[model samples]
Target chain A: MAEQAFVTGKIETPVGTVPQVATGVSWRDRWGAFRVRLGFGRMRYTVEPGLYGVGAPRQDSPVLVTANYKLSFDHLRTALAGHDAWILVLDTSGINVWCAAGKGTFGTAPLSVQVAASRLAQLVGHRRLVVPQLGAPGIAAHAVKRQCGFSVVFGPVQARHLPEFLGRGMQATPAMRRKTFSLSERAVLVPVELVIACKWALPLAVVLSGISGLFGPAAFWENVREHGGWTMAGLGSGIVAGTVLTPLLLPVLPGRAFSLKGAVAGLMAGLAFLAVLLSRPGGAGNDFAVWAWLLLIPAIASFFGMEFTGASTYTSLSGVRKEMRIAVPLQVAATLCGMLLLFCARRLP
Target chain B: MRRRQLYLRGVATLRLEQDGCMGCGMCLAVCPQEVFVMAHGKARISEQDACMECGACMMNCPAGVIWVQSGVGCAQAVFHAMLGRGSEACCAIEEKPGGGSCC
Candidate 1:
């Protein structure tokens, strides 16, 4: 019943009656995807794992396999607008195709089990199942064939190309097979990154502002208004630099390490913040505080930038470890030194 | 413009034993980075640096001749690992009472 919004009808197969899904993505699906991108109910967004039909699939229709994540299912069904296809979804615990494949949930065992559970052999006359290319990391084609009696054909990386791929007899071109992190792809990831960063940064900003009032010759509230405002600005700048600027300028930014690129973006943001601080009347209060902002902003930004490696498509575990070995120590040292400077600035007359 | 997006150089842990290769070309087809290529009827490591160590080739290779220490290149996961949370630290929802997992 939860999936009734997308399920338009039911198709009767030799095995049983399968839910027939609509090929067009409704406004509800779009809203759901947008909410997930904004970090709402992301982990629970899943569909029922089983066999589904699109456009009245027959026994000879090509079988397309995917993860149980609702987003993945929506994309696949939406792509096959006019085509009749059987969608065999594996239980990946709501994870997308690529990440689930890496975790082995989309691998041979689950595929084999789903094949048997769905009685796919009896429903489909063809012996081929089109799995997403990204799922290759977890699935052994030979092993799947040996266990389930279905030959696995790795499909194109994106669902948009499904129509063309199916049209060409399931043959994917080199471009279709390759994965590229485009501007839009990088942009879409930014919202979740910003939301995550803000959850911690906003609270930290308030604490830093409250601590800023503990010193200075001015009244506690006035100092809080001036110095505390500066601290909040610095934290905000770091968040924007790390989560927004770093991802948008990922390719063109200097340095191969994500931390280094983040530091560069942080430096730019820090300089801008400093310029604004200096330009304001009576804004330049404690010189040590200025130095603190310079160091702290970049350190914070660099750490957030490094966090993006997990979301990136090309970073390796070894490379991330190597970068962390050097960058983590430097970031820690900078943060400590910056905090120490802030203490000195506040304690001084 | 084709901006070159390169990660750390010469640090990928991917290794392939040429003798055990079956020339199935599965590695070539599955590799998103195109790290493998068919050379003289055998799969070869064409671009070692480009590999993200996702282990697609190793998993799909029927011969089981490839080896790579595969894991996510995420700093949050590394931090969790440092806290002894193990390598499976990925996007798990409600990992704690009210704590959400990092993506």
Candidate 2:
């Protein structure tokens, strides 16, 4: 594909790639971010990997580096809305810097390759590249300087602090480098978790409703109307507890294992389920629905909790393994017990 | 100032090969958590209590002294494992789940 030519609102660099970018997020960017939260067209959310002009940057401007993932790119540019900096975006294959760094795609090879390909040396007078702190995993600073003759300086952990970081002579306070998974960040992840779980869950509910026909139409529909609602609620709350609540409340949840914490959250959600069911008299046989949710909700929540550990800033692979050894079987046992209760509930007089 | 503790106890998913450590400050510089401190210029684990185990130090260490079984910690992988399939839960692993709808 031909490299895009210089446009009216773009900064032209010597590299021949005239990357166009505006200061704040466009409506498309906003909509795209919102769409991603809902798990719609997530993989497709990528910009072309190359250099972009944040403002009218000069040759002496400090060059900031980032991943080609559109969301990551947008965050960087948007944060620097009023600044003039040369943004050199590497092709991380649409993955964010933090994740792509872990996967090894956003490493030295690509950084060097993009630097050379973009003719960055000729474009800028300095030999320093400002990289995001999270991309430190994939990058070897000394090696980049050795290979490309450009020293790498990792910026603050959050791009929001970019202005302060730059204003303070590019030095980060300890707080700036600190990685925080705030409540809002944790909550933002819930929509996608809910979307993915519901993909199979809603369908399973429909199929299970049909399967309930073996118990006769009246019983089947009764099961469909009563048990199905609880099942959906169980699944929804489980996703919330595991992915959102667990991470947000990770520090407070008892036990070291993520699954354990999730189970606690699930148990709470299960109690809530019971309270709702008790209020409605005909909501499935009281004993069966209560027993099933009590078992199932926590189990489902446990799985989500352990899963959230993968996304957490506190989990280890070894820790996760240890957790799995103990937690999985228990989660399975609880889930199966719930299923067994449901199985028995289906057949009762 | 003390930060809020968010991790569980005695479960730091990290290993430091003391023999190979060049006492380089890479781990100290790269770690987001205050997991390491330089003692006599040697990288030592002062508080591995809440290490996110992102493996930035492991990846950046010139001496290859740091080790972390790094991968995404999503529960979906556990779900896959239960189904007798690879826990393709994280993007860092051999395969990514759902065509890369990572959270």
Candidate 3:
């Protein structure tokens, strides 16, 4: 396969345009779907840690660094198109460079060893290494310099803008340094999350609806069916709210913490639920129904909204911690209250 | 505009040396920061400030030329580290906002 061919070669790193699995290979295996065979036919495309070529030049080219993840190698190699360069791959257990660097896999020791193993000093003409910006946290520049006899220069965050950055002579502007969660960026995450959730949510919804049908009044059974549909809709809305709307409304969201923003979105979702209740127009329904409606909907929405913060450019661990401390308990209590309300409503009329 | 340092005040930084760069431009292409640039047959650090320390560039460089420490930006990982659960890996759990565990 073309994907595997790229994986095997050292001189040319494939660009991002290539799919994970090339044409001709069974598409099902490449996607890692259709588990019916259970490892009967598995596909792999991860790059092994070692030396590589970047750009178009031969052995004497500049050496770039990255993890053994094929995609990461592909992106870096593909970006260099016309130039010849050396690539040093680290062992990050198939994780991407950013995360591996954070965890110290891309740090000093491996770099020093890879440099020695690759005999990089003998292969290249310079002693300066260009490093990515995101990896800065894990690397101790002074330590690396002492060990490798090379200084470290921190570069921009994105790869596409490299040509212009190079044209401008190694200077980064404020905009270049700032990370933006663009629409396309946000949209990419939806499929992965949706794929994961679709597996469990569907079966759970069916079970919950079946349980609701066995107890309570006709209204409760009706509510259960409606609840299943609403729950599914809520999940989809959560994706839209977090992935689509959050990025667009990021500046205007109510709180400093993403959870708070989600909570606000949840409040809006709660109002929608209220509208549903109002449409029924039943006098003297138990407060349980109202309480449940208020609590459950918002909690669901809030949960999804908060999850988006993990993927966004903004948001801090401590901020998330504080928000969780307050929000989780509140959500749990609200859900319990809603269930209680459902019980109280069942006892009435 | 009230801008307070919410949580990431003590974050980290990764630096590369241009003198050691072979102009592979590998870091230049993979970084989310647009930090590295190619110049005069070598890769240079065009921008140093935009890095979040994710370290993707360092891991993917084939020449073993990149070096950096990186971690996920999600709150769960940091929270775990703060709670002394530093070894656990936490990813984004789409529906459970603020809900992460030690494992």
Candidate 4:
């Protein structure tokens, strides 16, 4: 097979000619990362699972393990810039280390198998492998040692901290071990959320707009132009409120439940939409329509917000289940009531 | 910076059978939330509420003392589970031919 573009050269090892990878991420790599962030070709962005050399590693070099997901591999390689290391890329089906580990694809079995497949025992002098800390969820350190004769030493949570952690003799500080959901980290997730939301929102908007045009007083096209436009705007606002605003202002948003926080953001977006509507010529004349939107926006936003709990860092399975039990019913009821009010408004005026 | 806390305090299902712990300290080394600490050669829960139920400690523990209803804390996954889809359905990418989907 042809070598990947990121492969700069080859290192002659006892097992075979191991591909030597670039330590610096190229513009192409950056663009690929950006594309995946937008949810395009994300699952397909994987490198071949094998052993790769970085910075002319020798038999005594540390063997760092990571997933075959190109992004994860890139992060690890880039962090090891000036250091000589052997990267044992495990087959993780294109998922990142953390998520892959959660799925058990990055567990003890894969680690042991990869170690044997790469002939790492012969390639490295030491009987140790530095696994990413997040992979601990799947990796049984004792089991890996027993199965492969190599003890597992988990590295820091983020690959960027590798240099410092390695400099400190592979000891991660408390801060390095802990994962934080900072603003920038949350912000990067917004694009994919928005894209996924739009996939359903656009179609739902069309359906709702069509239904609105069927009942309003004016001619079909005329009503479609007025009511339908407002319907699209309302749905758009709800999507933005849930997927964008809720995540951006997560910490400050009131209520502990993600659904509640999303509702607040949705209500704010609804009010902003109302403000824009009222400022227009012959402001939305129907009070029922106004009430409909007031209910619908928050409901829509809340549902989306609740979905975000999947993406959030701190939420626990038990806590999310508890929140969902109450939140789902409320969201459904509010949506039904909002639709009823909207129908009433359209029928009258 | 202060860590942001999640809702419903003391809600995590994470439990430790103290008698079974061998004090290997794997839980302390692997936990991302600092939920575990070594005390008297055995692992103890230092911050139970902080546990995100990632199952790192449980998976890494040699003594099999830790237990939690481990799964993604995602509402989407819950909804999928409610609809008869598997709990791992959250954030599933479109699968290519001969490939599997993932979060």
Candidate 5:
């Protein structure tokens, strides 16, 4: 409800009553955004594109432009806090401004169209539109100016520094322009990534657990308890290491490619798993079982890390492609080999 | 996250055509990697190593001297590319690693 309020507004623009912006966002909107980010109930998210008022703004307020992706919209308004401004949201089909800009949805056409659609010229006295720095790629400043008779000013990379940016005559300091991927930023993304990965990982885990049961000489339930649990545990650990821990420990983990970093974490996880088994009276199963994990766990972890290269700030498209070209085949082969060894371990006396 | 010292090199696909540079300083402003800097009033490639190939600089450059083989860095796109299946990944659902089709 509060989320909609931000998007749905009625304000007196020079163009006359237009859909204005909300004065504030509530805790409900923040929670909703968090839930959606976690891959929960995503369908309900989104707000209409148009001009919005942040606080109570007269015609002289600065008009900031952003995408209609609820998160981007929410973050922009949240950053404004006590300031009075006009937010002009372009319909990016629920994508964040940075991503949408790259996609061309947040490009010069949309900016120009939204300016016209929102009747922005009539609403604001100034001819300047402050756009997020990340959106610069999609916009041709000269083209926008030529088309709309308004100039584009690229603002700071992050929304939090908008106040300082606006206060300093719109001059962004060097630090404000830089984009950093912090732990919190990476951590917040884990839930959705993990959930997405699990769509495949869980089914594979069950299938492997069943395969592991075939090797055990014990009763069916006994096999399920031992081999199934162990197999599931192995897959679970790999998923956690690859998806969760890798991103958190990304900086500390060794390697330039995310795959290498993930493999390193997977190795650590596998070692810990081995340590637990070795602590038991008989140590961990036979060589097949032990070697099997060594081959599989890191493979899974490496695969996760490699997949994550897409999400990280550091990796390049060509770099990711290179990593996948080399690493993906190796990972698949290792996992297959590990599965074969597990088959051997199960069949052997 | 702290900036990594080295991402995968021998693969960045970034090229700067110095002849076309007019020192407009647009590239410097748009690059997140600090990949370019103005020297003698013309833009020069300072640290091509860290370039994530976001292409923001290239897109914003009025002189059009910058070139980067930009694409998404995520696995899903790679997954699609490798298999030649499943069009582009959903922008609404996926966090685009800039330079990919998701952008």
Candidate 6:
């Protein structure tokens, strides 16, 4: 009995996967044929910014630094489908390079040690390690050079531009250095934040609707159904705008601060709410409701949008601090005032 | 690009000890300041002032060797906390169990 024990069954959890190579030809030119692809299969390894050989290449290939997130790693590898490169992954706790760099995981000292431990010095003859532009917040090129005898060369923000960057002898033009937050970029964010927000909103809605029943079926129930629905819709749309649309249209949207851009988007959403309200037949008689909306819609949208600043690249710590000092109280006051007016109107009637 | 260091006043007086660092590289991975570096096979605080004192490194460190007594400067988080949700619930609002209003 002690010698043999039977294990009947086990369940395998599905971790995100990535493909080793991409299929379908993308861009074909004199140099080579590029392919576009997607996969969840990323090499399972802790990022330590050391030299890594890809596709059985020897150690002397061009060293490229990236974040540990599987997606980030896949994108980096995908863009270099036909090239040989030494990928140095920084330990970012499975976060993307840009966010991790912003949080400080992809910085100088760890990078140096990883390089040493990975025996990067012996692999390549040249001391130049190419790092992404966004990783600048955490990495000091000068420090890495002094410590590891490797001069850090800053690369383009987009992995797709790697060929062009390397072709030009590591010179990054304005377009390469500048990061773009496009529609595709913004759309990807919607699922996560919306999923997170809805988890809370659903339960609260159930409770609010429940409590309103105690005041009498006709008035309180009606109020909950109508007003509660409006609030949920508005809150949901605001979250979508800030986390999705705002970042996607970041350049086209107004103002340098992400909050301001989010505010502008929220204002657009507010106008849409007002339009819907005005379109109703009893719109004029419900002046108090209209007023409540006028105060609250933009405020809710603005607050939601402002919350996204933490996740964006455009906002600075000091700038966010200053914005919060001014923006928060105004949002709270507006929301409270709107709630109070609506409550008063119902109570009196 | 000229790397810009956003000047922070309070962090200068704060003491950040990396002496007992296990070289697990978690701090080097999470710090936004490019502050930590490995010297003599151990992690050390290289750039002191660049730290925003985000305390993410402190929170995520497995060994609890990293310590930074810092607070979030985000107004939204502060507002949530002022509304009675603890400040710890601030920056990580999305990470909350049932993500919703701070209440």
Interface RMSD of each: 2.0, 3.1, 8.7, 3.2, 4.9, 9.7
Return the candidate ranking by DockQ, descending: 1, 4, 2, 5, 3, 6
Residue ranges of candidate 6 with Cα displaced over 4 Å? A1-51, A207-223, A237-264, A281-285, B1-103
Arrange candidates by TM-score, descending: 1, 4, 5, 2, 3, 6
Q: On residues A1-349, what C-alpha lDDT tens digit does candidate 5 reach at each position? A: 4445554556665677755555467788878877876766554466787777877788788989998778778888889988989888898877777667766888998899889887778777889999999887688776899889889888999999999999999998888877777889899878876876787788888777776666677776677787787788888888888999898998889878888899999999988887776787766568887898898899999998887776777677788777888888889998999888877777675
Top candidate by lDDT: 1
Order the candidates by lDDT, highest first. 1, 4, 5, 2, 6, 3
Q: Write the per-residue lDDT of candidate 3 for residues A1-349, one digit (tens) a residue.
A: 2244543233432321111212122453335323211211111335667776543444344556776655556566666655555667887655555556656776778877777776767666678666656555455555677788876665566655555555576566545654666657555555543444444356855764654555546776686765545545544554455434554565577765565676676666666656765676562265666666666666655655565556566443444555677777776787678656655665465
TM-score of each: 0.96, 0.89, 0.68, 0.95, 0.92, 0.65
Which ten residues in a row are the worst by lDDT in model 4 chain A?
A1-10
**Which residue runs does candidate 3 get wrong by more than 4 Å?**
A1-3, A7-45, A196-204, A218-227, A230-244, A273-287, B1-73, B78-103
For residue A196, what is the lDDT in candidate 5? 67
Give the range where candidate 3 chain B is weakest over 10 consecutive residues by summed lDDT: B94-103
Q: Please provide, for model 4 over A158-181, each residue's C-alpha lDDT reduced to its tens digit, 9 standing for 90 to 100.
A: 999999998999898989988888
Off by over 4 Å in 5: A1-3, A7-9, A23-25, A42-44, B1-5, B85-103
Estimate, for each residue in A116-191, the C-alpha lDDT of model 1 and write its tens digit. 9999989988899999999998898999999999999999999999999999989998778787888898999999
lDDT string for model 3 (B1-103, tens) is: 2232222233345567666777766566556556577889877666554454555566556455666555455645655666775452462221343233211
Tell me the chain A TM-score of model 2: 0.91
Of the candidates numbered 1 and 6, which has the greater DockQ value?
1
Q: Candidate 5's residue-wise lDDT over B1-103, tens digit each?
A: 4454568767788888988898878787777777888888788887777887777887787787888877556666778766765433335443432212222
Candidate 6 chain A least-lDDT 10 residues: A30-39
Query: Could you say which candidate leads in TM-score?
Result: 1
Please list the residue runs of candidate 4 whose C-alpha ends up more than 4 Å from where it truly belongs after superposition: A1-3, B87-102
Docking class of 6: incorrect
